[model samples]
Target: MGTMGMQGPQPLPGISHVIAVGSGKGGVGKTTVAVNLAVALGKLGYRVGLIDADIYGPNVPTMLGVTRQPNITDNSMMEPILSHGVKFISVGLISPGDKPMVMRGPMLHQIIRQFLQQVLWGELDFLIVDLPPGTGDVVISLVQTVPLTGAVVVSTGSSVALQDARKALEMFHQVKVEVIGLVENMSQMVLPDGTVLDVFGAGGTERTAAQFGLEFLGSVDLNPSVREGGDRGMPAALAGPESNLGKPFFEIAHRVVSRAIEISRSESDVLEIS
Candidate 1:
C-alpha cells in the first residue's frame, strides 16, 4: 500500500524537501551517514543544506570541517557556513569548547526554529537535518515546526541497535512523518584476506525493516577510511567516486532520492484522486 496521504507542516521558504537522518541510539554512525548524504546530494548537483539539529551532540560541524563561526548579515540573520560544496550549520560550531548543551525543551525549540527560519539558507533543493539520537525534545520541535519530507533511520546489525531503530521509526510514524527508509550502518567488515565478518551479527536491521514493511535502503560496511575522514572533517563518501568507503554512500544517496521521488508521486496521485 502507498503511504497515507496526510498533510504535514509546510516546507520552509526556498527549501523544497526536508530529510532527517536519525538513529535510535548513538555510536551507530548516524552523523556519518548524514554528513555523507548531504555531500553526495551536492555531488549529484543539488543545492543542499545540512543542519546539525543534534543539540545533545553536534558533530556535523566537525565532520564537515567547519571550524569558524557562521557570519551574520546586517539584518541579524545567521549565514550558513559553506563547506565541501554544501551549506551547513551546527550547534557545535557556536558552542564553546566541548561543554555539553544543557538546554531545556523551550530552549531546544527556539534553537531549532532559529536554525530553520533565521539562517539564510537561500534557495535549496534539500535540507538534511541530522537529528540527535533518539526521539527527544528536538525531534518533537522539528516535527511541530516544519513538515518533514521524510525520515531515514540509521541502525546497525546488532539487536540492541535495531531495537532502538524500531523505536525511532515508531516515533516518526506517531508524528505522521513519512519514513523514507532504513540504513544499516556497520553491517559488516571485509578483511584483507577476502573474509567477511558479521562484526555486529548480520542482517538484524534488514530483518526488522522487513517485519515492519519498511524499505531497507541499504547497508554500509565498517571501514577505517570512513572514521579517518570523519576525524579530519571530510566524509568518506566525498573521498572520490572510485573509493571503496565512498561508493556505498553514493549508492545509499541514490536510494534515498529514489524513495523520496516515489513518495512524492504517491502523494500526488492521492491528491488527484481526492
Candidate 2:
C-alpha cells in the first residue's frame, strides 16, 4: 500500500499499513484500544504487529502479558516478541522493572527510530503503534520517522477528554497525517439489571468526531471484563468477536481496515496525478 506523501519518511519495507493510536490525554484507555484492535485484526487472520510507543508509560507489554525482552537477530535487529498472536516490542520490555525512563528529545527520537528501523518486523498487514497520551515529542518523532498510513484518536465521552481529543486531531492535521477515525473508549457502563448509564456523558466523542469531520469508528463500553483482561495481560479481544466485550473492538478493526484501504486508494490516485 502507498503511504501518504506528506511526511518525508518513507514507509518501512514489508509493512503494509502503519496505524497509530493516540489520545488527547491520559486515562482514556488509548493503549487498551490499540492492543485490542491489533488482536482483533489478528483474529481476523491478518498479520499484525504492535509497538509500545508510549516510551515513559510502556504498558503494551503488560497489557499483552509479555514480560521478556525481544531477541536480537544475527543481523543485530531486534526480534519482536510474540503474544496473543501479535508480534510486539516495547521499551517496557527493554528497560523492565519500574525504573523510570528519563531522557531528553534526542534520546526519545533515537529510541523511536530504533524501534522503527532496527526491529525484525518481517511481513505485516498492519502495524498498530500505541502512542503516548497527549501531543508530545514522541509523536513528533514518530511522524518524522514514518509515513503513517493513518491514525486513530481515542477519547472518552467526557467534555474534558473530548477537549484534549480535539488537540490530538489537530496535531495529526498539523503533521498532515490522515486520521482514520475516533474510537470512543469508556463510553458508558451497563448495569446488571440491563440499565445503561452515561457515566462519562453520552455521545460526546461521536459529536466531537462529527465536529472535526472525522469518522466515529465505534465505542467500547466501560466494562469490568475489559479492565480485568488488561490487568491479566489477556486482552478482552482474545474472547473473539462473538463475545459482547470483544464485539466492539472487532467492529472498530473492520472500520479501520476500510479506512486504511480508502486512504491507500486516495494516495495512489494522488501519486498517479503527480
- Candidate 2 Cα outliers beyond 4 Å, as residue runs: 1-7
The CA-based lDDT of model 1 is what?
A: 0.88
Question: How do the predictions measure up, each by TM-score?
Answer: 0.94, 0.96
Residue range 88-200, candidate 2, lDDT tens digits: 99988878988987888998899888999999999999999999899989888888898899999999999999999999999999998899999999999999999998899
* Alpha carbon RMSD to native, model 1: 4.2
Tell how far residue 109 is off in model 2, in angstroms.
0.8
Highest lDDT: give the candidate number. 2
Candidate 1, residues 140-251: lDDT per residue as tens digits? 8898789788999999989899889989998999888899989999889999998998899778888988999999888889878788899999888787557887888888
Reference-based lDDT, residue 94, model 2:
74
List clash counts for every candidate, in order.
0, 0
Which whole-number lDDT from 0 to 100 does residue 189 have in model 1?
A: 91
